[model samples]
Target chain A: MTSVFLLQWQRFRRAPLMVLSFLALTIVFVMVMAGSNPGNSMTVPTYAHPALAEQQQDEWLEQLNKSEGLQFELVEEQEARQAVLDGDTGMALQLMEDDYRLLIVADDPNRFEVESYINRTYAEELRIRQLEQQSTSGEARERVAEMLEEPALTVETQSLEGEQESFVYDGQLQMLFGMALFFSIYTIMFSLMKIVEEKKFGTWNRLILSPLDKWQVYMGHLLYSFTIGYVQIVLVLVLFKYLFNFDVGDQFGLLLLITAVYTFSIVALSMLVMGLVQSPQQLQAVVPIVATGMAMIGGAFWPIELVTNNMLLAISKVLPITYGLDALKSVAIHGRGLTELMEPIAVMLLIGVVCMGIGINLMERKR
Target chain B: MLETEELTKVFKSKAAVDGVSLYLDKGESVGLLGPNGAGKSTTISMISTLSKPTTGDVRLDGRSVVKDPGKMRKVLGVVPQEIALYEDLSAYENLQFFGRIYGLSGSRLEQAIQQALELVGLKERQKEIVKTYSGGMQRRINIAAAMMHEPELIIMDEPTVGIDPQSRSHILEMVRQLNKEKGLTVLYTSHYMEEVERLCDRVYIMDHGTIIASGTKDELKSILSGEETIWIELDRPYPELFAELAAHPEIVQAAETEKGIKLIIPKGKRILGSIFQSAERHQAQILNVNVQTPTLEDVFLHLTGRKLRD
Candidate 1:
């Protein structure tokens, strides 16, 4: 067993691509999917209406551009509304009956920002006009200006000690975790691919011919698979924590433990795949199907709540990742502890044992 | 120190290795001679404990290892016919791994790896990955991997199946060095007659999953004592006339060839006159003819009435 483990380690080091693919691809996933969208900046379009006074239009244009949080352009009236409906832009501002109205679709991430900006800008313009008409004296105008400057109601935000529902599109944590789980499939396939290479290279016969116990051979590979998957998950997690300053909540230790177990189960499951398939081509065909299907059902790609089918959701409950996500979400987001979440850890371990047992057992029988 | 008694294996209704008994004394080189599918590998497999015998037992140092194959594995270094190595790993890494599993440790394991690499003349390039190696280099490393433990007996199964002649000679020389200079025992198997003739003191000829003959090379060849072989390359096929020559009293054996036939005749016999007469009658012109002393190939022919390659 020691020999097998050492050999596998040496082999892994020699094939730098194998190690780098996991880290490199995961980093890309982090950058593309989990990148911080610090507060949004958007641009919208409207039309140059012929009926509006030129000076008022210029004043409104200057204010809207400065405060839209994003840049906008002037298009024809129909084109402006159509762009919003066609999903070209999230929202658009239109001038109507001595006021302004914002056009939007049913779903948009920038709905609140657009609506508030439009209302505040138009209300301030109307207030200034009303005050100027009533007070012509300089002293009265100064008093009215001071009164209008004060806010009607002050709103301050304070977060309580509880799970916070996500109101922003910061997918960094979810993307990071999803990629880590998805890569366990690669670890599994590569692990089995090494076995196939052994058979082709004829080293498998030497192993069989050796006096070493069969478990040592299987266990060595099993451990290597775990190590590879575990290392990749850790690297990605650490990046998210230190580089992005992303919140992994307080239970870092418990989160690490569950992830390690999750990786073990995934590696063992891959070993099962290796035991069943005889060639690299078979591995390529089978692994993608199995891993993608599992990730999809396990909520690694998108949240399971996004899935509307009851039958599909019910099936996903049996998958190992559902428990992994549940356990991970509890510890990383909800601040749960090991004692409070015993069942998921136990279930992950159970899956690992069953998978590793059957996989190694089949290989031993083959020998 | 190894022996098999009536060992057998049955795959479904067919027997791959039938009842056969063979033995190897200490510090002796023995050859298992047979064509393909003659159960040489199957017998080796059972002896190596990679497969179990259906009946009988393999005894190591006068002890049966049917139920458990332990003690013998410690003292035996096996070189499978296949390369049997990790190509992605460097040669040194491969040797170290094999040596460690064989129970060597620390500096002792290091020494064994170095010695094995040097034995195969691959120490200088040991750091390079095996995938970068030529076929012969890989074969040498394969042999080196087996020798890491310095086992009492080294069992090689057709170690030179498809290799350039230069590497083939190098491997043969390495085996000779291990067996003769080091006093290591060897159990070598091959289909090539010349390899066995040049290497082993004793030989076993196998056919149809059983040993037909086993003796010293000279002793086995003595089965067709005072025999001379005739090579007849004809212009065309001569089945009818060849049949006549086969039925003659002096012709010991006759096997057909693509162009003509090969005849094994008794020594000091004047059978060429009758052969030429038969060929003339068949209207087949003899392109070439040569007579030589009996070889292991001829002995195989005399015993089975078929070519060794057949």
Candidate 2:
């Protein structure tokens, strides 16, 4: 087993392009998609309607700018319209006294976030004005503001994983985790494809006819795939955490544990794929399809919270990457502990075992 | 030291090798001769413990290796038909890995690598990557990898299939030295009649998943010794005369050659006079005629009625 494992490392040293290219792609994709200030805020150009006075428009701008997740910038109506038309910004907001209009020229994923922010701000400001109109003391607005500082009643939002704050999406960590795990699929599956190549080229028969046990050979190959995948993901995560200043939470050890389980699950999943394939060319076509499909359907490209289709959510339940992304986000965003993470971890291990058993059985049956 | 008794392997109810029984003594080099799809590879795969026999026994030194292949694997080395070495790795590294798998380590492993490389005549180029080498060089390294542990029995399956003559000769000579000098028992399989004739002390002619004949080379060739093959060359097509000769009483077997016709007749026959008369009646011009003693090729042709390559 050691001999076979060591030989794989030597081969990897001779041609490290496939693995390295995946790692580099992960870095490039995250940097490009997430942009400079991920999760901090999204900037949306805003302009007041001409019927509104300058003073009222300034008040609306101040109220809209109070949101922590969406930054509203005041601009001339013509400039905001031109910004959307020229494709500079994906959307622009035109504010009215009682309502607002969104001039969207292109589809933007962050459009939901900006709209949610403006809706809540407008409702609160309008209600305060209404309260002030009905009050005889004429200090209803001030009292409402003071009362909001210390609310009489609050509803605590928690998840199944014990006590937790409301969900706060960290785009930097999301991109970092999502891309790292997604690209690691390619690294792991392509590395495991060596087993198929060896069988095709007949080197597998050489090892089988040798004195080594059959299980030893399999263990060697599987261990190599696991290690390479684990390293790529960890390295990518570390680089993003330290070099790019992405906040991946302070539970570093828990993060490593999650990566290990995810890597194992992926390795076993790759094994199942290998067993289904007949040749290396078939596997080459399969790896990308499996990787990209799993990423898209399993919520690696976007958060599962945003995916609402019942059938897709049902399919995501069976995929290891779904649990992997969930566990990772729970760790980074929700700050959940190990006990809370048991569900995802156990699900991942179950997938690993089931897939590995079926995979090896199918492969041996073919032989 | 090794034998298989009625060994059979069936895939999806089709027998790849059926009722094959052959044996090899220690230090003897035997050949398995057959065309493609003759189950030569399947037979060797079963014998080498790479595949399980569906309903037979492969015994190594009186112990059924089918039950326990560990001992057999420890003493057997297989050189597969394909170039099986890791192309991305250097030849030296490939040998080192194979050696280690067979329990060689430290100085012993290093010595085994050196000896295997030396045996294949690639010691000087051992450090080069296998993918960078020519096809012949890669083939040599393939043989070297199987030789890493110096097993007592080496099963080589068409080791010289697609190599240059120089490399083929080098491989044949190396096999001879290994068998004669090192006393390494060999079960070499090939479709090329000359390779088997040159390297094997005994030969087994197989076709359609069964061994038709097995014996020493002389013993196999003697199957056709009762008659001699006559090659009669004509200037052009003489279908009528060739048909007449084929219908002749004493012509045991007649086949049309590229030039004219080939006939197998009694060794002491003097039917050249009748052949000439028939040719003259047809006005067919004779180019040349030659009579030759029976070779393994003739013996195979006489038995199977097909060319060795066909």
Candidate 3:
């Protein structure tokens, strides 16, 4: 087993381009896509309407800039319009006395985020102004703000299971985890392709004729694939977390554990695919399809929360990537501990064992 | 030291190897000669314990290995027909891994790799990746990988199927040394007649999954001892003259070869004069003529009515 495992590493060293390319791709994709929305924040250019006073626009800007996830910059109306027209920004916010309008230009994925932020800020500031108008004294808005800060009646929303219901979306960590897991599929499946090549070329028979057991031979290849995939995910996560300063929360250890389980599950899934295919060329065609399809259905390209179809959500429950992404987000975004992540970890492990058992059985039966 | 008893393998109701029984003594190089799809590779697979025979047993040292292949596998080294080494790795790396697979380690594994490389005449190029090597060099590394463990018996399945003559000769010489000097029991299979004729001490000629003949090279050639082969080299194919020669009572069998018509005639026959007369009458040009003693090729043609490489 050691010999076979070590052999794969030696072979990988000689032809490390495929695996390294995947690692580089994961980094590059995350750096470009997730890096564009660091800290889930975007800078929106704000300009006051010609009828609005400068003092009122400054107050609106102050309220809008209070949001940690959005930066509202005050600029001249002409300059803001020019920026939007020139495609320097996706959209610009025009401040009015009682309302605001978004001057749209090019389409942006983060456009909704900017709109939601401005809408909430405008509503709150307008309500406060209305409250100030109805008061005999002019301190009514300040008193309302103080009361809102510490509400007399607080509503704590929870699921029927008594768990807190809150959705925290960090675009950076989502891209980091999604692309890391997605590209690791390519790395794992392609590495496992060595088994199909060995069988096709008859090197497998040489190992069989040796003193080593058949399980040892399989374990050698499986272990190598698992290690490569695990390392790629961990390395990408660490690089983004430290180098790029992407927030993965404080549960680095849990993320590592999740990564290990996810890597194992993917390795086993790759083995099952290997058993179903006849040749390496067939595997080469199938790997990308499986990876891309799983990424699409399991929410590697987007958060599972965004997928509304019940059928797709049901299918995602069976896919290991669903659990992988869910568990990773739970740790990185929700700050969940290992105890809360037991469900996903257990599901991933179960999937790994079942797929590995079926895969090895199918392969051995073919033999 | 090893034998298979009535080894039969069936695939989807078609018997690939039907009741093939052959044996190898200690330090003997045996050849299994057959055309493609004659079930030679299948038989080797069963004996090497890489596959299970449908209805037979393979025994090593008087123990049935059909149920327990570990005993047979322990002493077996198989050089498959395909180039089986990892192409991306160097020859040294492939040999080192094969050695470790057989439980060799430390200095022993290194020594075994160097020894195998030297035996295959590839020691100087051991550090180069196998994919960068020529087909012949890749094949040499293929054999060297199998030799890494220094097994008691080595089974080679067409190790020189497609290679340059020089590399083929090199492999043949290496196998000869391994058998003669190292006393490694060898079971070599090929469709090429000369390779088997020159290397094997005993030859088994198979056709359609059955062993048609098995004896020493000289003993097998004696099957055609009463006949001699006439090589009539012509300028081109003369179908009419070939038909005339084939119809003659003195010629037992006349087949068109690449060169010209080859006639199997009874010994001490004086049919050359008549052959020339027929050729002249047909306006055929005879480039050359030579009569030679029978070889394994003739024996195979006599038994199966087909060439060894057909």
Query: Best candidate per lDDT, number?
Result: 3
Of 1 and 2, the candidate ahead on TM-score is: 2
Name the docking class for model 2: medium
| CAPRI class of candidate 3 | high
lDDT of 3 by residue, A29-124 (tens): 999988675655778898888899989988888888898888889888899999999988899999998899999977888888788878887888
lDDT of 2 by residue, A22-85 (tens): 9999999899877853776778899989898888888998888887767889999999999999
Model 1 chain B weakest 10-residue run by lDDT: B64-73
- Model 1, B1-310: lDDT tens digits are 8899998988888888899799998888999998888899999889888789988799988887766677777787889898887777789888888887878889999899889888999989999998899888888998999898788988899998888899989999999888899999999999989999888979988877889999999899888787888999988887898889889888888988777788888788998998999988889899999898788888887888777778
**Which is the winner by DockQ between candidate 1 and candidate 2?**
2
- Off by more than 4 A, model 1: A35-89, A92-100, A105-170, A208-211, A308-311, B234-252, B256-260, B266-270, B277-287
DockQ of each: 0.51, 0.76, 0.84
Of candidate 3 chain A, the 10-residue stretch with the lowest lDDT total is A159-168
Candidate 1 CAPRI-style tier? medium
lDDT of 1 by residue, A1-367 (tens): 8778777877777776866887888788767766543223356787655677767677788767886245657778888878888887777777653587677776786778677777787787677667677776746546766776896766766558455444332255567677777876687568657776776666776776677876777677777778877888888888878887767777777888988889887887777777787677888899889888988988887777678899989888667787887777767766778997899888878887888788767655655
Per-prediction CA RMSD (Å):
6.7, 4.3, 3.0
Off by over 4 Å in 3: A35-39, A48-59, A87-90, A95-146, A156-170, A308-314, B239-244, B280-283
Instruction: Give the candidate order by descending DockQ.
Output: 3, 2, 1
